[model samples]
Target: MLTGADGRYHWPLPPATYTLTAHCPEDGSGGGTGEVTGVVVTDGRESTADITVE
Candidate 1:
């Protein structure tokens, strides 16, 4: 989990399929959610999964 003032994050993991989800709170009610699925991370490379909640 990530928490702070910055809206950026990063993670390093082994080669595999992964899923990333991001959520943002709105007002005082329920929040919004975004997800990125089937992210294939390979060896000796960089993979990006950007999620935006609006």
Candidate 2:
């Protein structure tokens, strides 16, 4: 996790291709899943989608 000034997670990923997905791991939170496809490298060059988990 990228730390913000408050030490909070600002961004969840780094430069790389990924199958970005989100799901509630908790039982009561409910089960859900989503995918973001073809997320290409997006850093070090105008910050163009170098970090994604879709």
Q: Which residue segments of model 1 deviate by more than 4 Å?
A: 3-6, 26-30
- Evaluated with lDDT, which candidate comes out highest? 1
Model 1 per-residue lDDT tens digits across residues 1-54: 674577767677899999887888777867889988999999889897778775
Q: TM-score for every candidate vs. truth?
A: 0.66, 0.38
Q: lDDT score, residue 48, model 2?
A: 26
In model 1, state the lDDT of residue 4.
Answer: 58
**Judged by lDDT against the true structure, how good is candidate 1?**
0.81
Q: Could you give me the TM-score of model 1 versus the true structure?
A: 0.66
Please give, for residues 1-41, the per-residue lDDT of candidate 2 as tens digits: 33357433334456777664544345665655545667665
Ten-residue stretch with the least lDDT total in model 1: 1-10
